[model samples]
Target: MRYEKIKTLSELKNIIKGLRAKNKRIVFTNGCFELLHAGHASYLQKARAMGDILVVGLNSDSSVRKIKGGPRPVTKEKDRAKVLSLLWCVDFITIFSSTTPFNLLKAVRPDVLVKGGDWKVKDIVGSDLVTSYGGKVKSLPYLKGYSTTGLIKKINLLTPRRCAVRTYAAGKKGNTL
Candidate 1:
């Protein structure tokens, strides 16, 4: 089940240790993932292809608010994690409340650290730490025209305006309906 894929940091650390012992390559990626989309799935699948396991570090609700400001993360952290857990390409998920995944990266010490093409390898957090340990850091290509913000804007545009609501109410003649 999807719930089984969610793990605490300590639990994930132990699991990573075991996987490493088995010579499994671990790939790590971090994101808010406020809303799952085709782009997210494609990127995750590509990241997983680079290693045996894919560990996604999800930003907590508060962390998302800090980075994206208010009214963001359309979904809560737990919900976001649950959604990511359902993806076949994602092996495990760990929620992090920090502004960045630098600490989480230290814990997992993934064989490969990846971010979207929007981020340069040198600018990606934990790039140095991962590279210092002989681990590879990658910048995956970012899919165009697919983003939570864009989706939200589209939804907003499709919604009826307040003037339309007022017109409908006037037609009701004070009826409860």
Candidate 2:
């Protein structure tokens, strides 16, 4: 019933400080999370398994559009954060407007930083920062054939025709129904 997991940068800083004092292993991961799919759920669960708490850096709507181009982030930032807050694996969620989570990661100073295998270790934002602080960095593989782009394509294919055709390829009349 509580949605306190979604916090602002300042609030998260305080929370992280307390968690660290308690010696909780914090794991951090960030993404646009445009569409909450099974792949995301699975990835978060696996990331959480590597530590005691999982903190997600949610990309803001404008950031998503800048990074992912137009027609992105079908869901709003607050909505995405709200949905992520529902996941048991997600201990905290913070909306960041930056294209990369470097600043947020610096603030979190998590015990672990994780990204999908699709990203190379050198390319992962904040990988070096985590490692510099003696934290672990991991690239977990994404679920096969479970991506937002693919889902959108499948949905487009299933959409019914808006206009009716009265003829077939052989010049034969066909029923609109």
lDDT by residue (76-133, candidate 2, tens digit) is 9999999999999999999999899999998899889999989988789988899998
User: 1-177, model 1: which lDDT tens digit per residue?
Assistant: 449999999999999999999999999999999989999999999999999999999999999999999788789999999999888999999999999999999999999999999899999999999999999999999799898888888777864443243334656653332
Report the Cα RMSD per candidate.
4.0, 6.6
Q: How many steric overlaps are in each model, in order? A: 0, 0
Superpose all Cα atoms of candidate 1 onto the true structure and report the RMSD in Å to 1 decimal: 4.0
Q: How big is the positional error of residue 115 in model 2, measured in Å on the Cα after superposition?
A: 0.3
> In candidate 2, which residue ranges exceed 4 Å CA deviation?
160-177
Best by lDDT: 1
